[model samples]
Target: MTITINTSEIPDTATEADRALKAKHAAMWASGDYPAVATDIVAALGGVLVDTLDIRAGHCVLDVAAGTGTSALPAARRGAVVTATDLTPELLDLGRASAAEHGLQLSWQVADAEALPYDDGAFDAVMSAIGVMFAPHHQQAADELLRVCRPGGRIGVLSWTPAGFIGQMFAVLKPYAPPPPPGASPAPLWGSGDHVRQLFGERVTDFVARERSLPVTRFADGAEFRDYFKRNYGPTIAVYRFIAGDPDKVAALDAELAALGDRFLAEGVMHWDYLLVTATRA
Candidate 1:
C-alpha cells in the first residue's frame, strides 16, 4: 500500500518558525521504529483510554498525535468511527497498515495537534494516548482538542507524568539536548492535573484524573532498557543523534539513562507511570 501525506491542511496562517519546528518533530519521530516501542510497551493504555471514554458505535472519534493507532484502533474495534492523526506520516502509514491487517476500518491523516484541520465540534469523543502531549505548545494543543469535540462530548488524554519513568528519562537527556522552540513548554506538563486544567480553563468541565503504572518486564536490567530505547524510541534516538559527534557526551548520556532505568527497576519489572485525564466539553 502507498501512503501519501498532504501538508495542504496546515493552516496558512502558521508562522515559518512553527513550520520548521514541526518538520523537526516529524523527522525526529520518523527516525526510529516507534511503532515497535508502542506495541511492546504501552499497547494496553490505548484500550484503557478507549474504555474511559465509553466510546460507542457510530460515535465520531479523533485520535490526536496517534502513533500507530494505539487508542484509535481499540476505539475502532468498539465500532466508533475513528480517525487517527499524527505529525509523522511514517507512523500514520504504519498505523494504516496495521488497521488493514486487523480488518479495522479507519482514516489516517497527517495533522498538527496545535492546529487540527477538523471543524469545531466535529467529533463525539477526542483522545490521545501518550500523544498530543509532545506538541510544542500545550495550550494550543489543548484548545484544539476542546474545539474539535461537541458540547458534552468526551475528551481523554493519557500522558507520561513528570515524575514517571519516561519523564525521568527525558530529564536525564535534557542537559545534552538543544534548546526548545520559543514558548514551548515541557511535554510532561500535560500529565499534571493542574496544568491541564489551567490550559482548558473553564472551557471544559466534569474533569477526572488518575495516575496509572504500566509494568515493564521486557528488559532484564537498566542497560538493556537503555539499549532498547536507543534503538526504538524516537526521542532517545534524537538525543543520541544531537550528541553523536562527541564521544564523551554520548558516553555520559548512556551512563545516565542506564542508571535511571536501574533506579526504576524492581523485582524484574519497572512500572512506568502515566496520567489519564477525562473531561466533557462545556
Candidate 2:
C-alpha cells in the first residue's frame, strides 16, 4: 500500500494569487514544459550550490520539495544520507523507482513544510530549490525549516531572479493570460527582496547572498516560447480556459504563441540569473 497527501484544495481565505498559482504550476509540474534540456539547466542551477553548502558524504540533509529527487537523488549519490519530503505522492513514486535503480536510500516522507513532523534540530542542513517561495504559509514554513536544522547547521534556497529574460518572458506572455492575483509568484519569493534579511535574521546567523549566471535556452522564436508559456504560466492557462474551451484552446495556444515570436526573440538566451540565499545558525 502507498500513501498520498492532497494539498490541492485552496483555503477560503487564501489570496487570489495563491489559488491561481496553485492551479497553474500544479498542472505544469504534473504534465508538461520545455525540453529536458531546460529542466537540466534548472537542476544544474541548484547543483552549483552543492559545493558552497558543503553537503558532504556523511551528513543528514532535508530535501524540501525534492521533486522526483532531482536534487535529492544527486545528494544521495554524493554520499549525504537524504530525507526527501513533498506533498505530491506520484512524483515520489518516480523518485523511489529511480533511487532503487541507483542503489540510493532516501527516507521518503509525505509532509507539509508548514507543519513538519520531525523533531527540533534534526538536520545538519535544510535546502529547497524553487520551493520555499510557493509555500502558502512561508513564514511558518521557514520557521519549520529552521526548527529541523541543527543550531549550527545551514539553510540554502535558490530561486529565479525576476527581471531580464525570465522576467521579460513572463511579461510578454502575461497579456495572453488572466490578471495575476496578489502574491501569486510565491516560490521565487525572495528574488532580490528584503524578506531574506528579515526572515533569516530572526532565526539564524551568518546570512549571505550569492549570484550565479544560469544557462537557459529561450524559445526558438517568441511564438515558440509563448506556446510553452500557455502550459507553464499560471494566468495564461486561466485566460485560455476562459476564452477558449479546452479542446480548441491548446491548439489555439500554439497559434497565438507562434503569432508573438517576433516580439520575444530575434535571438537571445532566456535570462536565468539565479539567486542563492544562505544562512547559518548563530
Candidate 3:
C-alpha cells in the first residue's frame, strides 16, 4: 500500500485553483441554493464513509478541508463528535448555516490543512472529502493528516476522478477562467488520487475507491450552473469578468447545456464523476 504521487506534469507555479478557490466559490454557492447540491453529493457518498471508517457514536472526528460540511453533518448524525476545519472563514460561515439548518452541532475552526493547529492525536478519525487533491504540497498535507490522528486511527479522503467528463469540463473552463496565483507549490493538483497511501506508511488497512456520477438536481438551467462556477471553480470570476454585463451569456450557456443533455444527461441527471478514498492509520 505505497502511495507515490505523480506530480511530474504539474506546473511549478501554483496553478490557478490555489489563489481564488474560496471567494468566487462562496459567491456562487450564495447565488444558488448550493446546500441542496451539497446534500445530494454527500448522500451519494455517505455509506462509503460509514463502512470504511467503522465510525461509531461519540467518536472524535476531524474533517480537514471540510467544505460546506457535506461529510461532517452525516458523520455528526452518526454520533461522531466532529470538528470541521477549513482555511477560509467565509466557508465556515456557510458550513455553520448548513449545520444549524440540519440541527447538527459541529465544532468549526478556521485553519490551514498543512499546518494544523491541534493537539497531536486529537481525533479518532480524519476525513477530507475532495480535499487533499487541492493541496499544493500533497506530501506535506498527507503527513499532517496522519500526524493529527492517534495511533491506529482512521483516515478517509475523497478525490476527484481525473480525465472523465468533469475533467473535460475543467479543461474547457481554464480558458474561460484562468486560475489565480498559487500559494504553496505553484502546481495544480491534477490526477492525484491514484496512489496516496504510501505517504502514510501504507497503513490503509481497508482501502476502497469508488466512482459515482453526481446528478445536479436543482440547477435552473445551464446559466445557473455557470453562476455556480463563479464560486466553486478557480477561474470563474475572471471568466465572468471578461464577459461581464453581457445579456446573452446566460442564453448561450443554456443552449450549450441543452445540447450536452442529449449525450450526458438522462432524465435530468447532470453526471459528475468523483473518487471516494477510505483508509486506516497504522
Candidate 4:
C-alpha cells in the first residue's frame, strides 16, 4: 500500500507542529531549576560582554533572554541603564533578588525574544550570553535584536558553536531527545559565523566574530562531568526525566555523554568553546 502524503498539506501541518514544539521548549526550560545550574557559568560571560562592548555609564542596555540577569546586572554595575528581559518569570524573579542583593537598580521584564516589547532604537547596546540562540524562530529573534538597538549601537552575543564541546553534547544527546520539528532551525546554527552573517544580512555593520573558550565545568574525570551535567543542567535533567521510563535508553545516553566528555576533559577541567559575535546596528 502506497501512502502518498500530500506534499502541500505538510507545510501547514509542520508550522503548527513547530509552534507546539516551541511551547514545549518553553515549558521544559520553565520546569527545571536553571538558575541553580546557569549562574556560575554565565556570570563571567556577562562581564566579558560588558568589556567587549565598552559599555559606558550613560549607555542604555537591553539584555534579551537575560537568564537571571547574568549580563544585565553586570551592565548595571558598570553604570548603564539596563533592562533585562526573559520569558521565564522564575528566572526573572531570581534576577531581581540578585540585583537587590547587590544594591543595583534595573528594570526587569518578562519578554519573548522574537517579539520584544521595547520601541525601536531604544537601546544603545543589546546583549545575550548563551541565551537568544534558543529561540525557535531564529530570523524573528535576530530581527528583534536589531530593531531594538539604536543606529550605531552594538549587539553582543555569546553562542555555543556547533563544533564546540557543548554543541557536541547536544549531538550526543540527539538520539535520546525528541527531534525538532521539520523546518525548525537548530539553535547551534547561531554559533556559526556564516549563519550569523546570513541572519543579520544588511541589518548590521562592523560585524565581528571570534572564537572564545569558557570553562563550563571542572571534573576529575569524564564520569564526574557526566554526573554533574545530568544532575545540574536543565536540558540534561529534562532529557533524563523524559526518558525515565526507558531505563536502557537512559543508560545508553549516560554512557554516550560520558564518552563524549573525554574530548573536552583536560587536567581536571572541561572547557567549552563558543562564538562571540558583535555588530553595530545599521
Candidate 5:
C-alpha cells in the first residue's frame, strides 16, 4: 500500500506545533551526553562515507545535523574543507573541542536541517551520518540537502533501518511515549530506499543504497546496555523521564527493551543495521 502525506495541508495551528516539536527535539538531544554514546562508532561510520564518496582533499563538504563532529572531523582530517551544522549548541561545542584536539580546522554552526543557513549550491558534497533523519520535517530536510549541494555533487546519508536494532528499540519504547504529531514522518523511513527516492523525487540522479552493520559495544551485557541507554541516550532518557510518573509503564518498557537487547546480542556485542545512501544532484 502507498501512503501519501500532504504537508501543504497542514493547518495554521501546525506552525506552533512544529515549533513545539522542534523545541522538544532539541531539548531531548541536549538532555543526555550523546557524545559518550556516539563517540565509539561515529568515526567508523564517517570512514564508510569517506570511502564510499571518495571524499578527497579540496572538496567542499557539509555535514548536516552533525553531532560531535562524527563525519565532519574525519572529512577535515582527510583534507576536505568541511562545515558542520547541528541544532544543539552543546554538541557543536563538543565537536569543536574534538576538532581542536585533532588539530583539524572545520567550520561549525548552529543550524537546523529543515532550514539550512547556506546558500544554493554552496557545497561539493553534503552528508548526514545518522542525523537529519530525526528532523520532523523530512521533506524539508531532504530539500535542504539537495539545495546546498552543487549540481552533480554527491549526497550521502546513514540511517538506521526500521528492522534494525535501534529501530526495534524505538518501537519497544513507543508505547510508553507520547504520540508524534500529525504529519511528522518517522525517522526510520530515511533508511528505506523507496522512501528516500520518494523524498528526493526527481531532484537527484544515480541513487544508490547499501545495507551495513555498525558495531555497538558500549555495554558489557544486555542489562548494562539497557541501563546505559536509559541513562545516556537522548530519546531513551526522554521517554523514561516522560513516563516516570507511571512506574508500571516504565518497568514494562524497560523489560521490553532489555528483551530486545538480548535478542540482538551475539557474543556480548550488538550490531545495528543501517542504510548507506548515495545520490548525485541532477
Candidate 6:
C-alpha cells in the first residue's frame, strides 16, 4: 500500500510574510542545478545512510526534504516502498525523471519538513540526508520527523558538522547573508550529537552517532570549488546574491570562499566532515 499526503491546505495561521519567505526558500533551491550537484558530489552519502538504517525489502520508507532522491532511490533499490518529499517541486520533478529512467518505483511529493501532512506512525523508517537540517524551525521539523515514524521504527539523518568544510563555508557566508526568520536555528546545529539529543530527547532510544569524512575530488583547486558552488548551491548563491550590488563585498566573499576551500583541500582531495545519527522511535 502506497501512503501519501494531500498538501493543498496551507495553515490557517500562516501570515503573508510566512508565505513570502517560503516562496523565497523554494526559489533559492530551484535556482540552482542541484541535481547535478547531488550526482557529481555527495552521491555516496545516501547509500551509506540507507545501510545504516538497514532498510529492507517491503519496508515503508519516507525521505523527508529529499533532494532528487539521494537516499530515497537507494532505499527503493533495496525493494522498499519509498516516498521522497521535498519543498521544491522542481527538484522533485527531476528526481521523478531520474527514477523513471532507472525503473525505480517511488512516489515524489512536495512537502515542508516542518509540517509534514502524513498520519501518525505512517512509515516503517524515516530519514533525511543533509536535507531536513535546512528547515527554519528546528524543533518543529524534528517533531515531524519523529511523528511520522512508527514506534520502534528506524530513523536516520546525515548532516554536515558545524566544524566541517560545509559548515565553515556557511560561517563565511553568514556575514553577507540576510537575517534568518525569527526562531530559525542554524542548519549546522543538526550535525551536533548533543544538539540532536536535546531535540529528540527521550522520545527515541538505541541512539548511535558517527562522525565521518566524505573525500571530495571534484574540484582541482579552491577557486574551482567556489565557482562551482556559486553556480550550483542555493545557500552559496543566496549569499552572493545578497552582495551582488557591491563589487568590493562580492570580491571579499569570493576570496573568502576560495580560501576556505583551499584550506580544506589536501593531496588532491577535500575531506568534508558529516554526522550520521540513527535511533529507534520509542
Can you write out model 1's per-residue Cα lDDT over 180-220, one digit (the tens) per residue?
A: 87899998998898999898889888998999999988988
Candidate with top TM-score is: 6
Greater-lDDT candidate between 1 and 4 = 1
Candidate 4 at 64: error in angstroms?
0.7
Cα error of candidate 3 at position 162, Å: 1.3
Model with the higher lDDT, candidate 4 or 6 = 6
Comparing 2 and 4 on lDDT, the stronger one: 4
Q: If ranked by TM-score, best first, what sequence of candidates would result?
A: 6, 1, 5, 4, 2, 3
Q: Write the candidate numbers in order of decreasing lDDT.
A: 6, 1, 5, 4, 2, 3
Evaluated against the true structure, the overall lDDT of model 2 is 0.65
Q: Each model's TM-score?
A: 0.96, 0.75, 0.71, 0.90, 0.93, 0.97
State the C-alpha lDDT per candidate.
0.90, 0.65, 0.63, 0.82, 0.85, 0.91
The pairs that clash in candidate 6 are none
lDDT by residue for model 3 over 113-199, one digit each (tens)? 766767667788998876556665667778878878877788887765555545555554454444444444322232344556555
Worst 10 residues of 4 by lDDT: 1-10
lDDT for each residue of candidate 4 in 1-282, tens digit (9 for 90 to 100): 111212242223235566566566666777656786676555567788889999878898999899888888889999988889887787889999999999998888877787776777888999998899988789988998998899999999989999998899888877787776665677888999999999999989999999988886556777777887787677787789879999999889878888888768876667788999999999
Candidate 2, 26-134: lDDT as tens digits:
4555454322432544667546546668888988888886667767777788888788886666567777988899999888886556666676777888887766665
Better lDDT candidate (3, 6): 6
Q: What is the TM-score (0 to 1) of candidate 6?
A: 0.97
Clashes of each: 0, 6, 7, 0, 0, 0
Worst 10 residues of 6 by lDDT: 6-15
Candidate 4: segments with Cα more than 4 A from true spot: 1-23
Candidate 4, RMSD to the unseen true structure:
8.6
Question: lDDT tens string, model 6, 1-282?
Answer: 779584455354556776677788888999878887999999988798799999999999999999899999999999999999999999999999999999999999898888887888999999999999998888888998999999999999999999999999999999899998887899999999999988999999999889999999998989999999999999889888888999999999999999999999999999999999999999
